[model samples]
Target: MDFYQTDPTLENYWRGVILFGRNVASYKFALAHALYEVDKSGSDLVTLEDLAVPFSRHLCQHLLHAPKQITSRGSQYLETCVQFNNGEITQDKLIETTVRLGFSNVIDAFHNVNAGEIEKRFFLDERKTAKGIRLTDNFFQLSERPQYQNLVYETNARWNLVEQAWAMGVSRNLVTVEFDEQEQLLFSHINARRVNITSCRDSLNGYQKGRCFYCFRTISLIPGDSELADVDHFIPWMARNEVNNINGVWNLVLACQCCNRGEAGKFAHLPSRKLLQRLHARNEYFVQSKLPLHETIVNQTGNQTTQRKDFLEKNWQAAKNNRLFHTWEPKAEGEATF
Candidate 1:
């Protein structure tokens, strides 16, 4: 079953935009951050100049950390953002550049996911008529939800993951993303120094659509919450010596507490063949998203689809053959989400 369709709430639709929307550049995320900033003012209609302030501010802020925000090499607008961050340009000049060049695509593409427009509209683009966007009722309603702050955090987390991937050149370097069990974050080694990318829960939860990897139950990303998701290794981490890059994105998934460590939880047991197929599908979603994780997974797994499938099958067989590992299946499996 399609997880996003299960609920189809305004929040889910918003998640769809942030989680599943294409990311050629980080513009959508910047626009999303700007939307939230503007929404706080209780303003339904916002001018382009008003929106550009926060939009450019967010891009400049992120540029300081992850310099490479886009996959492509050149961006005039981003250059202006960099100048603004470097104190080379005034804030007014940065805003003017953003107002002219920034919204060229993100405004139209923000609602798009998986090659199509989402069912709900967060904002109505009025660039031609009013030179700005008018926040829709759906957008306002979503902002009022209790999960609003969490959604903002998720958006920033996703942005960091994508930008870090691009900045690190994961596709070329084949950076192995390792999980810090104690910190519950994903990190990679650069120049022999470890760099944390993002919270494992926030990075992977979006791909899972906030559902448990095995049971398909709704999961939370908030810390210290009883329902917070766990960062699970699809092929038990104990088998790291046997399988290459055990901490790779392909091997990581988010699971509910019950499914990760509770009674009858997966633990170190090898997932069932059915769940293995689901794992394959979930990894493929990562590849298809064309995010930074895409090339990392492709490099670690395989370049071709059949080759990747075979890679997983080989790992599954190897794990299954090990006397130390036993096959496992969730007691109460929900619908197939991947």
Candidate 2:
């Protein structure tokens, strides 16, 4: 699915960066967190040294929890941050190292997605003038968005999911993502121990681009919000015996409450063919992301794109043939988002 085509809002572009941008290391996420922090200060121009403080601090904080930040072997900048975390290096020295190494690639590549640059540029690179990067109006405007805090939570959650996948060293075929209904979290078994990865809503919202799966309305990560997102199984979980891995990421989408279980919600009912097509596109987004969900979905569904599509189609056909689920569509269908 074309993310920009459905809703080309600034918030959607930012979510694209966090959700779909390739992660050789987690520098993108740290840079994102740092960008939000710097924006909160109401500063337009930030020196590399200033940005490094939060950038390195976030990496240091996460390093304490998950040591493997990169898919590659090692990162000198990360090593410096590790030293600082271990009290083996001064903060000043850590900042200096970060200014030199941390911004080497993330700044240049931050706006890139799907092999092209996004139309909206959040920050302008100004290192050639020795002034560091300058935040654009787009950056500030995004901070004012109602879902700003949700974006922040989503970024951190995505970072945690990637880092956990990296640290665990689970083979692509062996990664199994389990949902905790009571806690509303996604986790996996590591050495027979449950390791909570992240909030299911936070992780899935990025792929959904913060919109409800059915109506395309903006959803919230915060609690007590009327538009708060619900983790709906695209294919109802009641068919667990008929389908394998009914609660897998392939069958999950974030929907607003009104479209999930309200009077017109799709409770235990089959969605329209158009919605099924959207679900296929949404699952393809997860596979293209190459995140932890990528492996889990591939394992649960199929590896090849056609094979995955066939899996969903087969399940959908079986449910329809059984005549057990009545078809349901939203009363007010918004623009197609997937």
Structural similarity to truth (TM-score) of each candidate:
0.85, 0.93
Cα lDDT tens digits for candidate 2, 48-70:
99899999999999999899998
RMSD to truth, every model = 3.1, 2.0
lDDT of 1 by residue, 73-108 (tens): 799999999888778989889888889999999998
| Top candidate, metric TM-score | 2
Alpha-carbon local distance difference test for all models: 0.82, 0.85
RMSD of 1: 3.1
Top-scoring candidate (lDDT): 2
Candidate 1: clashing residue pairs, number: 0
